[model samples]
Target chain A: MSITQISVFVESRPGHLTRTLEAFAEAGIQVRGFCAGDTGEYGIVRFIVDRPDAAMALLAERGAAARTSEVLCARLDDRPGALARAMVACAQAGINIVYCYSLAATCIALSVKDIASAEAALADADIDLVDQAELARVLAGATL
Target chain B: MGTPMPAPDQIDFSALPIYLPEVECTSRERIRAIQLAKLIEQVGYTYARVPWYRDQMDALGVTPADIRTLDDVRKLPFTDKSALRETFPFGMFAVPMDEIVEMHASSGTTGKPIVVGYTAADMDVWSECIARLAQMAGVTAADRVQMAFGYGMFTGGFGLHYGIQRIGGMMIPAGAGNTERHIQMIEDYGTTTLIATPSYAMHICEVGEKLGFDWASSTLERGLFGGEPCPPRLKAEIEARMHITCTDNYGLTEVMGPGVSGECLAHRDQQHIAEDHFLWEVVDPATGEPVAEGEMGELVLTPLDKRGIPVLRYRTHDLTRVTTEPCACGRTLARMQKVRSRCDDMLIIRGTNVFPSQVEDVIGRIDELTPHYRIVVDNEGGLDRMTVEVEIKPEAFSDSFEEMSAFAREVAGKLRNVLLVTPVVRLVEPGGIERTLGKAKHVDDRRR
Candidate 1:
């Protein structure tokens, strides 16, 4: 199963990111993880939030070009090799991960070309596939 | 494409017919003699009937008698927009309002617009001049001319309408805008000649492409463009895209809208002036002295036959060089190079005249935006585009992206109401635009 991520289109300029973050802060929406990348003219800021529906509504009311997409979330053991084992399993299954980021010390969020295949590959390797409900619970106990 | 157009080299310009053989192809001495005689009569007529001209002549210690030779025209005081503004409405009109048959006005820098009134005879002269220019651009009585210029207080629409009528051509008074309808009419009505600004013509081409309409298959054979300067690159692009011959003409409301000078099909680079109707002079902008022949300078004009609002030595502020060398078309009239830039900071976007000060006025009214703004002009998709980047106040920056977008739209709406041209308005963070030390650079023109 996949979790939702919110993405925003912002101009690549000073204070634009600050303004986006300010919107999140004012709404009292806790951000689990975020990533920002730019292409000189404009930038995209993607966020993993606890309340995506509320975040989407807030962004829409603010006149932002914001949208939500599904991505896979996985929980691994606290041991260092746990992530390596999951990555080796996906590699052995020929699953291509588009991008991945650490949500917490033992949790990761990833987007892949074949989400279902990667989810099955991870699950068959005895890796835990986290859904929206499990994600909120795991993030609540994890420290940033 | 229905039929491929003949390459530029294959076209024989010298074979084109002259509309007014007697006047257009007359000897240089004959043209000057005609100009000299008319200049004297117009000077005396304006001096005797118009009080403003009398005062200006009296202050300069000159009379109609002083204008004996063409060289003596320099003694008369130069008239400019300030004089017109000072005498708003009918104050500068040589004839009474009862005799004034028509009136037109152009956008001014601020407040009231500069007005021009035309008597019936003045209308005849205007029509005749435009008729000659239209014929020079190869418009015949058989061609269907579609006039897309706005037919309101502006002079372009009516001026060309009467001119095309004078030629006995089919008139489709398809006034400005409605691009889709314009394209459909061209395909249905078989429009042969298009009259519009060059940018608008390019825009029409774009709309036609999106509609899956083949412009090359259409019957549009030629275009008469005015109201703004058409760069050579833009003209060539329009001709190639629409499969039509594009020609440019120059005029302003103060002097007499369009019909002053136009490009003959024989020579597309320079425009042949209607020398018999208006005396042309190129002078140093700073000193007001005539520049050497064929050298670029500010253009000063004196309408030899304008009876309603006769002006002497009107400073046009447009920069161009004039050449008396005979053209291949055999017309003896002096030809002027294309006007590329202006002495002032006025920006002509699409067909509308835009001044940076007007942008400043729009920005001044908006509380959420700072005074610091940059006006960037560039050509995109063969059309002129103006984007105004305004800095948002820090206090206003806290608003959501949706709010800022709406605020930008509001500013753009207000600007359109004032400028007559819509510009893309962008909201920038505080201090996003670069700061300059002296005389802040407000405009970045990349169109050239």
Candidate 2:
């Protein structure tokens, strides 16, 4: 019902974002979805990667500041307003969306305050939630 | 190359070894002789005028006549910021209000602000001291100096303003803040020298880079950074970013602003103290006993030339060591090392002493982290917990769970290595820490 999202704290400097992505690439960790929220001096880079632990170790080795949080991944039709429909369900369920981004094709990742409630709301609305194992498979370039 | 040699004394270069060559370049023996004379007169005058000093001297069973030699200065009682606070606004003034030409005060963030007054004669000495410091930093009458320190009640702005005016330097009272405008002014006015706190100078560089301003090629040749103790890392960073010769200066409102001591261009490691104007001593803060020469301790100062508020053994609360060794700048005045930290800002966490500046040093060195951070000390259960909330560079952000945790652990380890206490390091967004235009707030203690 929920997918684990890794969020890394990045300073607002040239090549910081590149350094972070390179850390994952060097470790051969494939990221399925990504969203970055910037506040001038720093940005929060959130990722749904195939090998999170390995990616984290590589980033740690390079001395990058990062963290992790949970978000829900829902299967949606590759059509217009699919994201808006999933978001409307979340809003109706009273689950606030911190941020959301597209995951591969026909999948959408939504960060929320309460993952369980968001999952319950989406289930009630007949929206299927992708689990972490499924996310790993999808991020590995497998068609979901 | 074929020009005839000119007489040594005939050249009269505008740049001199000392602003007041007769006093600053005088023999050490003569300097002390002058200090002793000024000390005796100041002691007697304070004892006669200020009731607090008279009571303190009376309690110590020491009279003005007992202060016969420079060593006799130990006989006088120590005056700390608390004494100045107790007296409040005008009680510390030795001379009457009519004689006070200018007044300044500390921030007083905790409680009452410590106020200080200066007479016209005292202002003359202040200007001369600042001029000497300016000349040391390569500022001359021909240059334009932009003062970034705040004006009004705070002393830094007015102190340097008058000092630069005294040296005949074109003064730009830019005050503080408005980074874009400050840079524009520098471009428009050709500001050759800048007077600001070290942190503010670093911030200016950040803004300059963001605005696509070429700060490296700016007219800023010298930076007189003071108001807060500047770490060597910060100084290096400022110099590298701004391409300016940055020198540190020290002063307090309790004493006089900005003119207490400053670094000469030849030697930026230690600051030259204006010994003739103010009698300085290094004493153990705990015992109030004078420490040996070259030993680190709290600074005790007594204004010898100040008439508005002649203080007796006023504790500066700043920690540093003094060396009488002659500087490469050719000035005979004693130089004090850059201030390490303030005793007041020192935090004791679970019996271990920690300075926020130390944490700042560590953060400054880490390229991934910005120097802006907050030290949060809170009481957790039965023990005290220290958490350092530092900003991560926006470019370093990655959504990797393992990466973020590892980064936090590494930062915590680095901090524990220096502080000897394990602190929970919280890495927030790049702009998470609050930025202030004035002195940066490094600590937020909630244990109290």
How much is B294 displaced in model 2, in angstroms?
Answer: 1.5
Backbone clash pairs in model 1 (N, Cα, C under 3 Å; residues 3+ apart or in different chains), count: 2
B289-393: candidate 1 lDDT, tens digit per residue:
998998767899999999999999999998778999988767889999877656577677897657676687688778877788899999999899999988766
Interface DockQ of each model: 0.08, 0.15
- Regions of model 1 farther than 4 Å from truth: A1-144, B1-9, B345-448
Which residue pairs come into collision in candidate 1?
A62-B402, A63-B402
User: Per-prediction TM-score, please?
Assistant: 0.60, 0.63
Q: What is the lDDT of residue B245 in candidate 1?
A: 85
Please state how well chain A of candidate 2 matches the true chain A, as a TM-score.
0.89
Q: Which candidate has the highest DockQ of all? A: 2
Find the 10 residues in a row with the least total lDDT in model 2 chain B.
B1-10
lDDT tens string, model 1, A48-126?
8888999889876766666687888889998869989989989999988767787854778887878899999999999
